[model samples]
Target: MSTVPIASSRSQWLPAYLALVVATSVATGVASWMFLPRPELGPLLLLCLMGILSFQIREPDVGLRISFSFLSIILLASAAIVGAFGAWLVGSVSMLIDRRQRRWTATMFNAAMSGFVGAAGAMVYAMLGGVEGSGTVGLSTVALARDLGWPLFAADVVACLLNAALLSGVIHFDQGIPFGVQVRRVLSGSGVAFVGYGIIGLLFVILWYPAGLGAFSALLVLAPLLAARWAFIQYGEELRSHERTIDTLVTALGTKEPAAVDRSRRAAVLAEWIAEELGLTPGQIGTVRYAATLHEIGHLGVATRLLRRSPASLSPTERRVIDGHCVVGARMIEGIDFLEDARSGIRHQHERFDGTGRPDGRAGQDIPIAARIVAVTTAIDDVIREPGAAPVVSIAEVARRLRGDPGRFDPDVVAAAVIALDKHGWPAGSPAPVAS
Candidate 1:
């Protein structure tokens, strides 16, 4: 549904990939036009206009660079109404009118991908005996369902899968996200909505042909589509607000403990990688990210002098007060509804695997998983940023250091961190050789 632009620096294979997609799309469009019967000009043009309009109305997604739009429904309806060539035409032409400024490569890639997805869906529809262009007028509901329903559903499923694959392919190259991870993210986030879109497309087809409503069918469906878009826009806004709140808290913490600003963000990145490596659910992954980012927020309540002092110089009483920051941080966000699950993580992040850690001495798996992951990630970040440490620590050295601590950290979480760091390497400013 979207095409992310690759950075110019990492674009070695991008031009070749875009060229291949565009070429494949053109070949499919030409071959379908040459072999298939032409669809009616009126319906074809109307559907193309609908497709263009749908593409223009897009909502930003929080988890992806891609935007969500009703273009899929239009593409599905085009496949059911107009055979392969017309569907391809609708899709390719829809990308020509964009409101946002974008690179030529992005436009070309999106147009080509849309065209391919449409043509492929239409081909699947035809292969399953779907008749195009006003052929459903005389059939009873049962007969219509038999001939049109299954084929359209199959085509819809194929279109969704093909679209996800194409989008994932581009994202993998552009953003360095593993293709399998991107695919799973897409499926988990939008699979149900796609099924709903298929049903909407089917209704549009039924209204256009069987009920003789023609283009008015589009108008009839416009309200619900816009309502859905509006709802998602609101959800996106709420997520942005949550981000702003986190920023405010982080900024406040930075005022008291400047080292925390960058450390929290770095810990967040590492924690998310480790959570993914451990195959945690997406919701749990999000909680881990939040916990890691705010793990040191307790520093806000500690004295500035205490935080600035070297660890070896701190008195036991002062250290105990410093340790209570975890508890203090948990209470600070207790009123935040969305952060409720993260409270336990912040509260328990200082807990050790061997039951000797600060405040409450909860050990092993008795500690929240988010806390355990955050503990390892924050330690990794601390070591990477440690004063007098090597300019660039190797992954093996980092792993060795983690293992050197023994029962201080959760062994499983430590292993997951090592594997994740080895596979992905550390982020910028914390360079480490990928482990062999």
Candidate 2:
């Protein structure tokens, strides 16, 4: 996430924000007039086709959610019609139509954003020496390739960057995250696909004008597109399946170790709150929750009787099993791609701030932040849920116990936990200190 903080209000960002709005409006208006009156039926149909092909993909583990509409429509408009104006109308109209059911603010924002992006692309194309309305640049393969390649590519790059910048700026303002983080997240999830689609769109328009394939070529690609959509759907389904499977395993473990179950749930809740207090992004919070929920999963591999016994009463061999649960639980989910971050958190949850942890002797800030937060939250839960203990404890006592062992947990995490616990009203009592 961005290390930079957001201003308390939107007016603080107004100067540059106003510039963007004005430039976008003027550019779009000019482009629209250049394209004139309205789009032909063929282009309108293409816009609808693009919308129908759009799909939403969400990966909860990594916290990435994206709605992807193949880049074909925008790219085609940029290459074929009245330069960028064609793209603007296609994107804005399609978005307005599709999002009509959404809140007015959301629908208008989307429509305006689309128009701005399209206008930016068209302006870039014209500036790059691409003539307006010369969709068909028919020449020999080499000549046409040499002529249109650079301008088209540049236009695509400009559009991509503009889209990223505008979106990232808005997100940064809203979420108080760094622009770089938002940009990196967007690129990692969708950049490559967008670029590839742009290339295909350029090729499609080339064929439309010269080969006379026209709009019918879209029909030829329909089967392949549908097939690709099916593959994406299958991939998304498997992602959901992975999440469900992990939940089931964790629930089963809880059933076997009923005491640990409540503690785990509490740990998960506190960990998420602490993460938020520490300015972790939503994706990071999700990963922390998973790690906290399954940190004790290694206990599943140990004997049930052994788990029920107090840690101090365990034999050396039994202690080893207990110590090794982190590794065991991490191994179980290591192979799943999305849980890569969570695996590290689980493996290191037992590590001490002073190099006194198991599986590894890592120390200080070297520990994963998620793991550190989990350790503090888990400790709090353990203290409150001690057998025969009341559901309540002084928030001060909880803080003292957590801070009392600086060698065991990260101080920063402990501090965040204190604030988070107080904010969330933990220990099942008032925020004021009470006798333990």
Candidate 3:
């Protein structure tokens, strides 16, 4: 979950939500101090230091607001070695010393959430018959596994669920995103990483006690963890570079018509929604976005005067030149490796479903799915932007127009577009009311 504080200016429930989390954490810490056994100072200090370092060295997560780190491994191990109060201390202190400058609300929320996760995990570990600290010293590997394995694993699951729940709560209150959606996103995005953290946390415990490495076990684990962070940084950079390339192309397209940029972005969003409704793969959805954004790029190849003129004023020869922009846009990006699949969509976006329209005249299912999606989405955007047309009225009209024109659009794609629009509504400024 994201450590960044969502702006609370418009959200009435966010401040109240943050206060509840902070208060719950304080109560947990107080109870742990009152009831749990005191932890060994030396090992507790070592874990606290390691936890602070883990937070500082977080890895970037592409397409997500949350940062990733091996702090979970440290927290889980601390639950076993330091007892509940010590675990809470380690988590709280680590956040208090965080070097990143942030709003006080964010700092408080993160620290409290971390402490709560630690204390809860430690409590679960103790309840599940887990041995802590010197209790497992010199135990055989098999014996240690029998005593500590399931407890530590269970502790890890509790930590994962609690952390996701708390984070999802703040997001739901602050951004109005549904609670269930954020929870599912957390599981799908980082579920595997959490499982690996549990295993590594177990290994850290074994190294500290049975193998007699103690605090030095942290040093041995640091190497691979840092390497993984480096790899993710490179991946995030590559994704950013791809976005930069797409932006350059879109900016060039905007030079012909200033409104083209906004239209392209709106079309891309609608196309993505339609793609999701149709259950397309992630890669195919990405291709549809690219195709929608660059669908009008061929106009750059036409003369400025011809482009400025209305379609009704253009003679037969001029109209053909205007219509050929699709081919021109396709050729412009043919050498771009990442856009190879999108090229086909851009090349055929103007084609009619019945084979009566376009440079290639491909009909029905013969047309690429990405092209069909772009056709319907762009048409909707065009209709919505017409002078004096109400957004709600335009949406209904566009849905009817697409459904009624079987020869112009794929019937299946039109149906998906209509459903997606009704479910999610249109983008900001277009204010489409959801169908009841």
Q: Estimate each model's TM-score.
A: 0.90, 0.70, 0.76
lDDT, candidate 3, 1-436, per-residue tens: 2244556633677888889989999999999999789899999999999888887877645433666667788888998889899889888877777676457787788889999989999999999989998787877778787678889998999888888788778876775545665666565556456656688788888888878898898888777667656755775677678789999999998887777788888888888778767767557777898999899888889898998887779999999998898899999998889899999999999999999989799999999999999999888876776565653464577788777777999999999888877755785556464343
Best by TM-score: 1
| Per-residue lDDT of model 1, residues 1-436, tens digit only | 4444445524466567778888999999999999987778988999899888877877756355566677778888888788899899999989867777377777788888899989999999999998786788888888788778989999989988887888777766665556676776666556556656788888889989898998899899887778766766776677778778889999999988887888888888888888877777667877888898899998988889999999889999998998899999999999998889999999999889998986688888899999999889978887776777755577777788989989889898999998878756785556554333
Candidates arranged by TM-score, highest first: 1, 3, 2
lDDT score, residue 325, model 3?
89
lDDT of 1 at 32: 93
lDDT of 2 by residue, 19-55 (tens): 5654675567565766644446566567445643441
- Superposition TM-score, candidate 1 onto the true structure: 0.90
The candidate 3 region of ten consecutive residues with least summed lDDT is 1-10
**Winning model by lDDT:** 1
Model 3 pairs whose backbones collide:
none
Local error of candidate 2 at residue 91 (angstroms): 0.8
